[model samples]
Target: MTAPEPYAPAPQPAADDGPTSLVRAAIWVAIGALIAAALVCVVWVLIGGQNGIVGRAFLTILLLVGFAGATILDAHLAPRRPAWFALASMGVWIATLLIGAVMIWLPERYSWGGFSRFVQFLFIVLILQLVLLHVRLYLKAFQRYDTTFTRAVAIVTIILVVALAALLIVPLMLGEYLWFPDIYWRVTVAVAILAAVGTAIIPLVNVLFAPKKPRAAAPYPTPYAVAPVAPQLAAPSAPVADPASVAAPQELLPWPTYVDGATPLPMLPDGSPDWGAYYTGYPTPGAHVFGAPEPTAPQTDAAHPASSGYEGFPPPPPLPPRP
Candidate 1:
């Protein structure tokens, strides 16, 4: 049989469809949401939405965007795409889109007592999310495009983004560049414009310049290189495992079948079994599979030569004179 290859390619991972039930998880979600709402309500009651109608409008938008971001994060990081998190995240996205649209288009009508400057920030976030979603849906590493096509896409994106950036700011530019004279307002406008252009350019730049083919991961370094297989034969019969070597079992002797503490009774020098004390000593002697010999001392034999008599186990207490 042929030797096996050094490594087999790892299997590709499939997306998890995830569990069907989210009902069990809904209670925890509800509790968390309630706690958050209570905290926010308390803070707003004390501090109020950053003061003023414009400030309040901004605060409302900020809150919406923040909540949307958190939900999106939950969806992304949640284990196994659990139904509760997924549905909750989608619901948040929908709410954000709706509220953001209302605030952007009709700031005066639906504007709550929240900070106002945040409306444009929400717009920027919406644009970024949409662009990200597009990349995920359409970008394919396996599919290749002509260089000209990619360059065109990148250019068109850049132009559209620049136009949107202008349109997003032009209305506020009326009067003296901005309604609110605060330096922060100016900073917000600049940040929004930068974000818009960046959001457009980065993703397209990757599409245009990045290699379309998926880069194969470098094979892990191995101590030995495999001999190249010939293409002529269609996989010479799959390799068989080498037969394992094991030692044969040894046979056991019968007469001395080992059992815990199964022993013959002790003997006196006169060659008689000392049954009285021996029986007392052996309270729980184990019985061997092959019976032990009679308690007589060893007879003349090669296994146990006759004993040249010796003192008793404890020498029988100094002969206990005169007693």
Candidate 2:
């Protein structure tokens, strides 16, 4: 069989569709509404407003409706065509503007306290909706945009953010700008205008400039590069040993066999058998002398009397002298 091919890295999946422009548009509008509300709050606090009637009549109603309506539209448009959402959003926008107009022209008791409260509530809801729907939309769009465009957008956003923070802290610099009220207001207005324009432009710029094509990543190194390799050195040779230095051959000896029913005892130095001490009656041949045989024990009366020597027996020997 042919050699198997080497393994390769798997390819990355491509994104088919990114987020739509309607979502990006929603983000712009939401930020605009928030900043507008914040400015209105500061302005209202300075200039003051009627408490009961205007607060409830315009600000509260408009804010709730706009936020609620935008959320509903987002939910509906997410799955369907973006154009439908855009058209619906336009209606909400027009309605909000009209509400603003009514608040300005319509007669009411303008209490600063009530107006401030109303503005606070309005700003809260709008900010919430903006976070949920608009910011999410911005994130989705950013995900689709290329790295270069994303970085540019990020830098611009940071600059605008610093400007907004400066505006928020503007009242602290009142003393320096107090002598030239015209210059101070002019600068504040310019900053506000720039911030609004930047808010509007960011999404549009990203949509226009972000790369449309999905970039292909660089290819991986081939198998030939990763292969196990031998070092460049002297060529390998067959291992050999000198036969003369090897161990000498050893001789095999035959074992002795034993006779049937007999055990071989180890030989004594004189080459004789060594019986144990239990057979003591046997003569130790060279050292001891033998005497006459003694009489045997009788088996019958007649034999017994003869053996005992009652009548015609030999006389007994006399005793030896004492020493």
Candidate 3:
């Protein structure tokens, strides 16, 4: 009883740690990369350089733009977690670009066979990733809104991009000459250009047309009114009586008795008048006066008074003995 209880630490409230500086810097870096790549690719396309380098650069720019748009949209509009689709797309583009740069430097440094084929395979993979990334971005942006025309545009755009990407990437990757062998690379470049434009435009459209959230309604108060009550009047009191002048009470007359045979009234089993039996033709046995003759059953021949009427009728059977 004398010993003091051990001291306990108080519970601490949860800490709300927001985004760190490093994360903000990384997002800015991604955005800068996207913008720088897009500018360089546009300049390269305008200069009209070698097909191989231009196509690769253009596709890389398209992929970068798509990734950056998705990431920015998610950061602003999405929940706390980053968009996995955008992150994956960005990672793929970075890896492909780094590998391509390494391959270009290696060929110059050493004689290497199959390097071109390897680059072609990498580009093919890049094209696939770009298609998937664009599809993801379109879905993310248009999913929240109720614009039918915009969604339809997105669907059609995605389908065309995939088909064009396939047509351009497959033949070159497989070393097959199916159609338009000379301008095949140009067609692929054109498709990449279209995809980049679409990626840029779709998000802007979403931001412009997105539905605004409705405001909350104010609460209303209900009023109650009470009615006024009327005042009640007291009842008048009776006059007092004089005790000495009060009249003597009169004796009550006796109830009248019914004389026998005075009127033809029906009687009940307890000798009370049965008014119902008197009105009805079929009277009860108690309705008859005492010492009166009992009524007999009517003969069928006497009621009919004709032998021909009784011809078709059968005779009545004898009654059973009483128990």
Candidate 4:
């Protein structure tokens, strides 16, 4: 019979947890921001509003677009549906608007400027949250890809985030004590621009250097071919001997089939002792003794006929008894 083939282990599926979608979203957001900036300039010219109004509107829209783009990217990259990112962003925006209105109404009704501090605090918290969120997303991407480029990018992003945080917090601290620095706004604007540029560039670089997918291996063969049949010869039947012409079969000596410390002989399919195996195995009597005498027939004696009967001998002199 033919032997069976060896078994091979199955290959595992690749993980689908990369930030490709986020990278694409960031690219789109950058393009949209550029377009929005141009449109804002046109609107400012047409409405002829105060320069402050245009500046504030442009900055607010830019921040909103950045946050919205990030939210969309996160939702697309996430494993599940329902886009929790979109929902969270919407909730935060609505809450901020409502709180700002309440703060404005309270200050006007009670003639208190302290309520303005609350509005500033809320804005600071929101900015901090957005910064943290971006940092977290970038860190996650770095971990997932685990490449040299990604590591460098992650480090750069983290450093920029730290610098931006310092710029923002330092100004706020100074403002709280009524000691605003002359270059505070300039430093803040410079850091913000640098961070935004870096954020936009990171995704583009990641997408460019992303790993390619491996091709699938060929499958094993099905329904293995059947083993070829061997031709068998039929055993010949033994001829029956004539009763009167045939001589009687000789009887074999009654010797031990097994010896001490020897293994039992194996049998054939027909349940007969395999003599070929027996001869090839254990040694026979007198096999090791050189010039050993062959077995002789037993001597016969007239007084002990029974002892000589095995050799078909007539009686002869018997052996004397021991003293």
Please name the candidate that would achieve the greatest TM-score relative to the true structure. Answer: 4
Model 4 residue 102 lDDT score = 29
lDDT of 3 at 23: 46
How many clashes (backbone N, Cα, C below 3 Å) per candidate?
13, 7, 0, 4
The digit string of per-residue lDDT tens for model 2 on 1-323 reads 97756775667789655336765576466556645654654455456655444544455456546655765565456545555445445444533443343343333334453454345334533433343354335445665654765656645654554454444333332222235467766777776676556455557766787667879998653322111211111256455487688675333222111121122211223322212211221222232111213322322354453235446774222211112
lDDT of 1 by residue, 33-129 (tens): 6456545544554665333545444555566566656654655455565454455545444444444433333324223412343555556556545
In Å, residue 58's CA in model 4 sits off its true spot by: 37
Alpha-carbon TM-score of each model against the true structure: 0.24, 0.25, 0.30, 0.32
Error of 1 at 100 (Å): 12
The window of 10 residues in a row where model 3 has the poorest summed lDDT is 224-233
Estimate the overall C-alpha local distance difference test score of candidate 3.
0.52
- RMSD, every candidate, angstroms: 26.2, 35.6, 29.0, 26.5
Q: Candidate order by lDDT, highest to lowest?
A: 3, 4, 2, 1
Model 3, span 138-248: residue lDDT tens? 778777674777667677677778777777666644442235566877777787777667656667776787777799998553221111210111144375587578665
Evaluated against the true structure, the overall lDDT of model 2 is: 0.44
How many Å off is the CA of 117 in candidate 3?
A: 2.1
Which regions of candidate 2 are displaced past 4 Å? 1-16, 53-76, 82-85, 90-94, 97-323
lDDT of each: 0.43, 0.44, 0.52, 0.49
Query: What is the C-alpha RMSD, rounded to one decimal, of candidate 2?
Result: 35.6
